[model samples]
Structure formats: C-alpha cells, structure tokens
Target: MAMPVYNFGAGNPDPGSFPSQALAEATARVLEGAGETLVTYPDPKGHPPLREIAAERFKKNNGIDLPVDSIALTTGSMQAISLVCQAFLHPGDSIVTEEFSYSGSINCFRKFGVRMIGIPVDDEGMNVDALEEALKDLARRGEPLPKFIYTIATNQNPTGTMMPVSRREKLLSLAQSYGIPIVDDDCYADLLFGEPAPTSFYALDPDSVIYIGSFSKIMGPGMRLGFFAAKEETLAQVLYWKIDGGTNNFAAYVTAEYLKDHLWDHVREINGIVKGKLDTVVQQLDAQPDAFLGHSNPKGGLFIWVKLPEDVDPVRVLELATERNIRYGTGKAFDSQGRDVKYLRLAFGYASHRDFEEGLPLLADCVREARAITLEARV
Candidate 1:
C-alpha cells in the first residue's frame, strides 16, 4: 500500500485554487487577437505589454515611478537571481543576505564562487544594527565589500518575517554609506491579507535597489512568470545577460490580459485561502504546546516558521515525520553551512485544510518522538 503523504514543504500554491478557466479563456483570446505579434521571436527584455502592466502595478502600489524599459521578464524569479549574480559576482567575492534565505539563491551565489555573509533576522526581520556592525568590521579589515545585499524583505523565506520600513530605511542608508547595491526579491509581496506590506526598497531608492516580483503566487506557479525592475543602467546589464531571447510570449500576453483589471480580486481571493490555512495550522500547533514551539502569524507570507525545544533536532524530527508520511522543510536547508537548527519552515500555501487538521497533530507526534529519542541518547 502507498503511504498517506501530507506535504508541509515547498512554497507552491494550492493546485485547486488556480483559475484555469479564466486563464484558458485569456489564452484563447490572446492567440486570436495577438498571435501574429506574439508568435514571432520575442524581445529579450520582455513583451512590451507585460512590462507596462508590471510597471503600472508596481508604481500604483508603491507610488514609485519606474520606466517600462527598466523591467525585464524572466522564465522565473530564479532566472533573475542568476542574472544578478552573473552581472555582479566574481569568484571568491561575497554578498550580504539574511542568514536564512531562499536556497535556490544561496546555491546560485555559491555555484558562482560568491560567498554569502549572513545577517541575523529577528521578529521584525533583518537587523540593520547587526548589518552595520558587519559592514564596519569588513571595512576595518579592508575586506572586499559584497557585490550587493540580497534580501527577501517583504515575505522572508523560511522565517516568514517582514522587515519594517524603519529598518528598511536604515538598511538603505547603510548600503549607501558602504556603496553596496540592494537586490530586493519581493516575490511574495502581493500575497497579503491586511494592510499592504512595507514599501519596497526599489520604491525608496530605484538607483540602488533591484526589485523582483512574481505572478506565480497570484495566478499560480505553473505560469512561470516573474519580473525584475532596476535602473536603466542595471537593467541593461540584465538584458545583456538574458541568453534566452525571451520567455513564452503567449504566457506573458495571457497574464497581462488577466491582470489588467482582475489582479486585486485574484490576490484577495488567494490571500483569504492562504490566511485561513495559516490560521488553522497555528491553532493546531498552539494546542500541542509541549511538542511544538510557537510562531506568530506572519504579516503576509507563505510560511509559518516554527521553533523547537533546544534539545530537539529538526533532522530527527523529519525522520520521524517521514515514517508517518508527513513532510516539512527544516531550517538547515536554508543555512549555507547546513548547521543544525530546531526550526521548521512549514509552508501552508499549498496544503489543504485536511493536510492541516491531519498533518499538524502528526507533526507534533513526530516532534515528541524525536525529542524522547534525543533525550535518551543524551542520558
């Protein structure tokens, strides 16, 4: 018999929640109306219509005026990360990022022989004070400054923490002081429930910050659409490195049509679903006080990062979870050095209500089992 699996990992969206009918209708319309324009070899920068939508949405939300020429569409946001590294990173060079960041990005930097200098994150998000100290120490030692400070400030991965605007301003100030650039991945910014997320770094300082946004979470990940907006000078470099002529023009056109007026409604619908999942999981975890450590509901993000007792090992906990057909992402995956941590980054985005009701308690049981085994070994 097959195992009854409950996945609490992967930042993917709920498959059932996708508006496939709308997408199909839009796709048919795009081909019928714009097939002649889109079928040809597409521009590397992006389809002009998609770029305009991206720019308009960004400016409308953040109140920042960004030129359409500054936006570049990618196969996905990971492509944007690769282009950024290719443009700025060299072997043995370093970049600053939250201690816990997207693994794909961390791998991208490491593969290119760039180093990740991790800055600690707290409840509010990346600590600007700590960043200043690190920056000062590096200058004092005459060490080469990082290529840029890569951050996912809006909906931080693994930690699901949001950086307040004050810290963002301070970070930008420090980066300016050090002459470092900022690569802000606002991938999860639009998946908000309440008050809008803090202003983006690019909104505050376009000249120094490269901002990224995605249509995956809003429209569903299968769309494979994301955008990067930077100053013209920086955008030129990204375009130069865009080896693939362009992403699927049909995808771009269909998404542009769908987002033309329905974006807010779509975001709100998905946010309600994800927010409900988060609430359900948080409630269940709260009930298992001994087995599960608590985490506050994030302002707006896909994950709810949970802590464990000092003696509990996430690896062991995962081992126990697997036996029960449950899967969750542990913090070690996000750590560059693969250090042990009593933390789990449970993504509620894709999980269903059943996954929560069943998996949460199973997770607590797994944790308790792991805790007892570790305690016995210590004894």
Candidate 2:
C-alpha cells in the first residue's frame, strides 16, 4: 500500500486528544436541562450565558474586562473576521495586514473588494515601524487610512511568531495616533507551551481593538465556537452584519458546559502534544541545514513556518511533495497578491507523530529536489 500523505495543511488539534466523553456528557446535560433552547434561535449577539462566561474567562486569562455588551459569538473566529470586514471594508478601501497572515482572513477580506496593504512581520510580530511607514505612505498618497489593521497577534498562522509586548504597545500607539482601528485575532494565545507569550492588543487598547478568540485550539473546531470583543459602536455594526441570527447554540452550549472548569487543563495537554510534534519535525529538519532556511520555534501552536533555500522554488517543492504524498501550505496562500514565496507552513497538528518522524525528511528531500529543478531551469 502507498504511504498516505501527512496532512500538514490544517492547524487542527490532534483528534485523539479531543475529550469526546467529556463533550458527550456536556451535551447530555445541555439537552436534559434545556432542550427547547436549542430549537429557538440564539441571540444574534450570542447566547447570554456563553457571552457572560467568555467575558469572565477572557478577563481571568488576559486581564481584559470585556463586558457582555462588547462580546458577540460567531460560527468560528473566521466568521468574526468576515463580520468585521463586511461591515467596515468597501470596494477600493484599504486594510493593513502582516506580510504573512491567515489565508482565510485574507480571502474573506478580498470578497469585500478591499485593497490589502501588506506590512512585513518578524520575530516579535508586525513591524510597528513598517506599519507606521505604510500608514504614512497611504496618507501621503492621499488615500484614506485603512478601515482597520487585521492581524493575528499571537501564534500567527503560517508563521508562529507572537507579537511581543513592546511591539504591541508601539503598534497601539501608532494606530491610536493615526486614528486607525485594529482587528486583533488572538485565537491562538491559549495554546502557549512555555512562559505566557503576551497580553492581547485589546488589553492595551480595548476601545480601538476588535479582539477575536476561539476554542478551536483548546477545545475542538467541531464545537464551532469563537467570540469577539469590541467597542459598543463597532460591535453593534459587526452584529448587524452577523446575518446568521446567532451562532450554533448546541455547539456553544456544549462548549460552555465543557469549559466550566476544564479550559486550562485541556489547553495545557494539547500544547504538550503539539510540542512533541514540533520537536520531532524540527529534529529531522535540523539534519539538513542547507536544505531549508530557519523556522519559528513556536512557544506553542500548530505550525512552524519554514523558509526554503533561495534557489529552491516553492512550486517545484510542492510538485515533488504531492508526488510523495506529503501536503503542506505554501506561504503564497497567505498573501493577497499570491506572489511566490520561498516558505511552507508545516502544521504539526492533525497529522500523527509517527507521520511527522517519517514525512519531514521526505519534505526535506523535496526541498533538495526543488533546488535541483531550479538549477536545471537556469541551464
């Protein structure tokens, strides 16, 4: 039988780690307690208990007191981004984003027909200086400042770099000075493996930041639970665009039931699981330095962004990877322009640990193959 591909495209939690029994129990409790509520439409703002609980948990974890009025539940954090962009972005309007970012959010913004201004991000996260420059350049050109700055501040997708506290402050200062709002995606913050990474941008400037969080990393994506906090005015507009009437009631209720006490424990266990995957994959890649460039040593998350050697074409690497039944996300996916980038998002989530031990070297081999193709093309 052919060796099945290692799927490293999704930043999903390990399926085996999902507390199926716990969730099952939670579901039973919800149905037995209030089965009728599930059939009724949930509040467009969100189910009240879920919102209240989320606000409490957020404050406990991040030191940000997002009141119930400021919060709105969504199908997933992905939907929160959509609601913001749909309500704020118009055709020809501009928004700033990390040079490397979440592909889903990028794609979602594009549908609004807004222009995306890419600001390059680094180890400590989005370069505030570059963001200032980008904003200034737009202002100088007489184009209106972007409607908002969209960012994945912690455990950034594709690139797992968290924005350091220093940069987060600078960023807030710059945005506030420019009167620009921020769409902060903090979905991956709870996945930290080591010391706590940093506080939410919303914590520093709650009024100016629309903060989104999710249970996908800590609980389960199938739960379809994510929520956001924003200023009253901004949140009202966001809810107006939330045409779903409400988020999934049963999923939200079950998650609310599951998280009454288990949030931190579940997240800690997943972090260790993800860390083991990261360790295995990194060890294999370390065997061939010249084959690839450096990767982010994620404190905790599903991905390590690997830069390919200069001569290696990412498309060629992908071509060879597909042949070998190895799947990975190219950095190109995260870009609005879809320009070629010499990088790959290798998700250690979802895929098996044994697959990591086996697939990574094959991935490195593909890198070498891609380099060969580049050399051949030049001849």
**Best lDDT goes to which candidate?**
1
**Candidate 2 per-residue C-alpha lDDT over 73-125 given as tens digits, one digit per residue, 9 for 90 to 100:** 99889988888888888899988899888889888888899888888878877
lDDT of 2 at 50: 79
Model 1 whole-model lDDT (C-alpha atoms): 0.85
Please write out the lDDT profile of model 1 over residues 160-241, one tens digit for every residue.
8888899999999998989999999999988877788888889889999998888777777677898898988899887778
Candidate 2: regions farther than 4 A off: none
The collision pairs in model 2 are none
RMSD of each: 1.3, 1.4
Candidate 1, residue 78: lDDT: 83
